[model samples]
Target: MAPSATAHPLRGREQGNLPEDVSSFVGRSFEVKETRRLLSESRLVTLTGLGGVGKTRLALRVARDAQRTFTDGTWFVDLSELHDADQLAQAVASTLGLQDWSVRSPQSVLIDHLADRRTLLLLDNCEHLVGPVAALVQTLLRACLGLSVLATSREPLGIGGETVVRVPPLTVSAEPARAPAPADVPGGDAVALFEQRARAAVPGFRLTAENSATVARICARLEGLPLPIELAAARLRALSVDQLLERLDDRLRLLTRGDRTTPSRQQTLRLCIDWSYDLCTDREQRLWARLSVFAGSVALDAIEGVVADDGVDGDLLDVVTSLVDKSILIREEVDAAVRYRMLDTLREYGRQRLRDEGDPIALRRRHRDWYEDLVLRAQRDWIGSRQVERVSKLESEQSNLREAMEFCLGDPPSAASAMRIAAGLYEFWIVRGRFKEGRNWLDRALADGGPPTVERGEAMCVDSVLAALQQDTPAATVSAEEARQVAGRRLGPGRADTGDAAAVARR
Candidate 1:
């Protein structure tokens, strides 16, 4: 196939079917430029990402931006509405304004109609019909010179020479260097998008000095994904920023207002994730749900440790890579370790599946066990020159650790595990100045009533020291006495370490 420039120019007005976007378009300036460059070189360019990361919008905007360049026409065919692969070619033919009456196939009609015309077809939502779409695109490009196809899907079309652009979430400021002024708002596409939709939902809504940080927080929590941000911003008509943040824990339920004109699968945050979720293989589906056990970006080993089980059988890395290919997981390189993460929206959706199909409690317990082993390893490493590295690792794994600890505390048999984990990380708590948080976990674990094992004694010792650090001397004294009694009973009659534990607690 030749570049769009070499095709014959049509006599009539350019025959195009690109739809006009009713709402505003935000971000993807770089994506638009790169896509246009690729379209100039390749017959097919696919924009792939999670369902609501704005692939369709970016494809449309890019098509519109490059339409004038295609003299014959630029057209859009939304395959999202077409269910069967058999109906795919018909959909394309109709989009191209061709009505076939002869014995020729729709595919033949499309090829013959655009044989010499310089045309671009923007095919949206191809994941559901990847095989048919790939075949159609491959056939059309081979037969019709000067034809280009831009496709959007949850994964790549996997055809030879297909230029795949993985669309990313909108930009978010992870941490502001300082307090941001109104000037900073425009640069963060995620915040800018939130502000735009908020204004639409509530006429006077604006990101103010007081709420700018909150708005950024909201975006960060949503991982800067566009659909969630749009749904969140729309809630401003009824909920404040603080309220929205509070309700984000159940975001799938909270973020239900999608544009009425959009396909029904995109009508809510849950439906958007559901559409993607349904496309996965059984192993992929089970792994996706189990991976919700992670707190943030997960190292490959961590994923294997947590997700590999009897029911979910496969090479863990292959399953994970498949998820990445399907845009369910985002792979990140942090330090020297490769990690993968899901957007919170997807994570919540997966967590719900974990609850439905499998044992969330068992999975969470496994999650807790993995983190417990991790903390112990970090504790050993912290005593050496790798202390800084260990600290950074601890910080990175903080969310997962917290999740694990919470899991342990919530289950009776796991209280001992929580106590052991809390006791093992006393050094981390003290160095990081998280005495109160450590104390709270320790207190709750002890309150849950585990046996007076050595782990419990150690936890009591750490709790006493934490109480002392918080200036609660009476509570410190009481805890110190309890620690001494438990240690003496558990560790034998005259262990000097028991005295040391009590003295450290008092001091």
Candidate 2:
């Protein structure tokens, strides 16, 4: 066979120019200038934001643009695939396109080479492996003044002198003009971007007077977030602009399938997240869905309580830790422990999946039981010899426990469980310093009662603490007295009767 026309002079270099992977980035001019300014002055410039906001694209653009400023060509290391921090330096060495270094650690070798040389290092997707990434960046900056790094992530490296730039979503244009009188609304980088991408899919797909307003409106609703807009634009083959708009109220459903022709993960904006979830095993998936119950971050012990099915097979901590490694869950380090979170976007996606997969009554019952058991344990432990230790443990789990209690009392599974969970966590409130949370739980347990008299009375005692915490003397007096009345009621000498008496006033 003769040499083909598609063949290049250099083998691998030809394929590197593909648009989806990394090329001369087309848009993102505003980010380029800020990145350049940071790279020139700071030891480290970390570009941070929600995923798919185009951090890697912007970083590459900055690196290519700044290559001439350094004698050493820019080095790029992508860390998304690396879960363990130990691999950080090896990955960096390989990405510098470095080959011969068997004598020492790759990082040491790279540092030795970097000592006398000046280069721009572009580290992409560092959020998943931040601890290792931060340590390495700090080490490099201390040992070598000649090196500059442009890192992209969902959060910042805590290396001192690190300049953090948050990448905001793309700008949107005026609403799409689907009406007879076309309005001229102003547009931004995101609007111009949507038109450019749409045109790529269909010839002559420009923003004309006929549909310009509606186009802008669509972009704005999607938050001018590039990945979603691109996914939306790619769907033009199957649906009209109007149809896309009509269906977007449920964005997860509307945006599942994407331009298979696009890229593997970025095919659909939703699929970007779906890929992360698909990468998890069954336990991880269940943990992720249950994690949606938390609106903000929660501690590991809390997760362990709510999701006891953790281990190599169903270990809660290990599963959550893996999700954190995969960047599906983000951790905020404070004191000695790590607090973990799912993004608002991701949390919503998990919630939708939970609703689809879980039985509502059953889920609520578990919610009630988990917190009920947890608070009972905390209360018992708090009254034990290790009161301080018990209080700290309860405090750690307070947020999720509070969430479960509120879930129980608000529209709880059974009024019986609701009353008990609220009454249970009430002592946890005093111990955990969650006065407001406990009071809220107590109030709901009482106000929404179809609960038994003993449960309701125990709930009153719980409210007394809440009222006392807030300096509401009248309510405190009322609830304490109410508790005494229920507690003093004589037992009927049966197990059931004793159960009511026990609830009315704990031993």
Candidate 3:
């Protein structure tokens, strides 16, 4: 386990900020220079960029460079999988041991304790939970006059006192069409990084006139990003650089190679992700592949909406929680709320497997029904503060929400399920200011005819409500009256549905 600051004292990725091997910092000289200046000038400095752009490495570089500026030495806090913002202070306190953070009010204890200490705080991976992390940062900076913080995130924390250092990908030169290896370009940064990664994969690998230009072009295509470069390099045992380049479309195979010696884990970046994936049983894999249908991070209950197996009744939450534990999925943080996400590369891997292994027709229908049903439930939960907690929980689980919706729009699942999910999300869509998305989904769902089911009436009712919300008062009145009339004729007076048909209509 890593030894960063956290409420429960994280057991992995936290044993320390990073390893002592300064072996991979081959090409980021410019980033290091400007980052040093930012740390020196600001109390809080955040290195922000897309995932795998070397933010963690840059932050570590700054901490190493800033070693002399601190009196108490530097402390690191890693919040990469932190799902709850309420746990932020406890996590910090747990790692710092500044006070008893195991209690319910760790933030107060943390503020009081940090008020007197002079130190450098290294907070890595702050993007997923910028709001809460930022809130904690604001509090800490306000109270701790002697503390300075250095963080890494994909985006800025947006706090008033924060100075954000935008970390771009490692440098790349244009690859000429059908490029040739340039033997004479000595000392280029791209060549250096490629040689460095290749050596890590195959001992003694180096740039020769024969492969130097080929190496350089591969790095350029990869944008000199370390993770992908390293992943590609790890395949050198079975692939020449050229062979690997040709197989870029099947990136999974290109990135992974046999490395049983490296703990059967951490063999390659692909292996690292795969170990996390394989640790999940078949069911988890199925759920993961289905969940990959979502883009970006999604809330928890979103899983409940999109992933129940059509062939059998399965426990969706248990499966999701299992993925989180295995590290195949990540629990994300929003201010006061926790969301979840699948890494982009992993999501791609899952989607392919989902298509290959799932029963296409059945899975599609199930996907539609589940999301359709879940959205209706979500709609009811959105209005009033009555189900705000549940609503947030839903938002957190689907980590792949955007992708899941795409699945709903195609073929057999279209129209009926789309209308139901769209109409149900109207209240939430409006409140969350998702104005355009709500209208799009509603319009798509209401476009034409739908399958006849117990859910039809409820879906129609939801459709009317959304129309009303969109300011069609007459449509709203007409739909509500139709719902009452339908209830009287179909359900009989005083024996009206408990809206159970809406639940079954999703069938």
Candidate 4:
């Protein structure tokens, strides 16, 4: 319900160009109502959240619903593909069907045209050129009393009097305790969204008891985010729910299908995260790649220790803060300690960048070194009054420790470090009932056949202990004998190999 661009006989047909919704709008009734309320109270309302969180869709929906309030009509301008800030005003002007050939600036033209109209302008995807967009919006609002602007951005435009409404991912139901009939399932908005898209992708697809739980798992795994859910649902045309859920570990590659009419950046999960990545500064991008070494939420101290380097030149805190503002990094306060994390999709994208453009080996080695240091410190303090704190720290960093150990084991030269780390965690593994996991790491590291060293000897001894605990006497005896032989020889220095140079992509 947008005003027509054709000049009305009285005031020219309501002058607006809001695109029609191609697909059904999913649930966000609360968000829609809140955004509309803010629109009424303020001249400027910005919808902000992570990319692909349905800001544009919600904005468009609200615009359509509130069109009757604006006698002059509602207009939508998409800035996703517009990279040049210089063309920001021109883009809005062109979208409004402006045909002025005069030398006056587009801002002047827009101000003159909208001065007397009770118009609603919906600016979609304004995060990239937020500064320029903010300046323009301020100018237009000051010149036009009746104009109201609703913008969608990953971050807020920091202009005075701007109201920010964060659009969170759709609410998703917890895993059902028991599978029920489709009608009995109380799947939330995320399930409803997936069902709708899945039906379109595969005709007659229904939420039967057999697949309902899998569907719920799929939505939960996707964190109830809409774009990922939609992309995942599309795979139902070619994959079963179980298959789709199993393949979601590599979601960036698996969810590559999308509508052809949409922008290329939005056509896949990787590309969507890639769009956000591209908006970051060079240093910020480097930090993003380095931070990918983490498995889950990370404290600021951990990031500073592992990610800060001469390659990423800047105040690490500032860069981290910038990423948070841009929605590339999510900040949280857990137990009164600040931490940050990237979305799984964003982490995958950063990992790909690290492999393809950045020095993956160096960054990962630094990551390993940091975690290794933590493990060593924890071992030294395990027998004291801080034993509980040590245990808590080790438990919290378990995933990071695993990632570091995996990296060391994979790289031949770092096999000794891997053995050392595994040996150091022997008590932790035993206490945590991770006997099999400890043995697995030791086996992989010993299989690398590195030079005789105390580290390797320790690893073999620990492997023997774990094997004996598991009642594998044969393997335990072999490891114990190997440990004795390794201890008898002098350790040699490891040779380092240069990693291959990765080609950088031109911006």
The candidate that achieves the highest TM-score relative to the unseen native structure: 1
Tell me the number of clashing residue pairs for each predicted model.
Answer: 0, 15, 31, 4
Q: Compared with the true structure, what per-residue lDDT tens digits does model 2 show for residues 263-351?
A: 22233456546645665687877778777776457777656655564322455667777676555676676456678877555777788
In candidate 4, list every pair of residues with a backbone clash.
7-12, 7-13, 8-12, 8-13
Off by over 4 Å in 3: 1-23, 99-104, 173-187, 249-507
**Model 2 RMSD to the real structure?**
20.9
lDDT of 1 by residue, 1-507 (tens): 101211122234357867556467877778889999998988899999876788988999999988887888898876654544765786576556453333345677778878888888999888889998999999999999889899999999999989999998888877631334444564378888888788777888877777877888777766677876775675576679888877664444444443333223334445436645765789888888888878767888887787777367768888888777555777776677777877655776788888887567877888888989988888776788889788768767766776788778668888788988888888887665555457767887888555668888878888887776665667778888887778777777777265544665566
Tens digits of lDDT, candidate 4, 1-507 = 112222212224355777656467888889999989999999999998876778888999999988989888798987755555766787676557554433356678788888888999999888888999999999999999999999998899999999999888888778642344444347777887888788877879888778888888777767777877766676676689998777664444445443233323344445435545665789988888888889767888889898777377668999998777555677776556677877655776788888898457877888888888888888877788888667657766766787788788678777778988888897787665455557767888889676777787778888877776655567777787677667655433232211110000000
TM-score of each: 0.50, 0.47, 0.48, 0.49
So what's the TM-score on candidate 3? Answer: 0.48
In candidate 2, where is summed lDDT lowest over 10 consecutive residues?
1-10
Q: What local lDDT score does residue 260 receive in model 3, on the 0 to 100 scale?
A: 26
TM accuracy, model 2: 0.47
Off by over 4 Å in 2: 1-26, 174-186, 250-507
lDDT by residue (tens digit), candidate 3, 1-507: 112222322234222343243345765778888888877788989888756667887788778777777765577776764545655776566446342312225667667666776778888778778899899889889988888989888789998878988877666656422222334235355566666667765787767756766776666656656656655665676689888666653443445343322221123344434544555577877777877655566666655655664321477677777666544566766765556676655776787877887556555565556555666667665655667665554444332333345456566545555556655665555444333244445445445645434445565566554444444456556655555555666766875552422332222
Worst 10 residues of 3 by lDDT: 1-10
Q: lDDT at 105 for candidate 3?
A: 58
Ranking by TM-score: 1, 4, 3, 2
List per-prediction Cα lDDT, in the order shown: 0.74, 0.63, 0.60, 0.74
TM-score of 1: 0.50
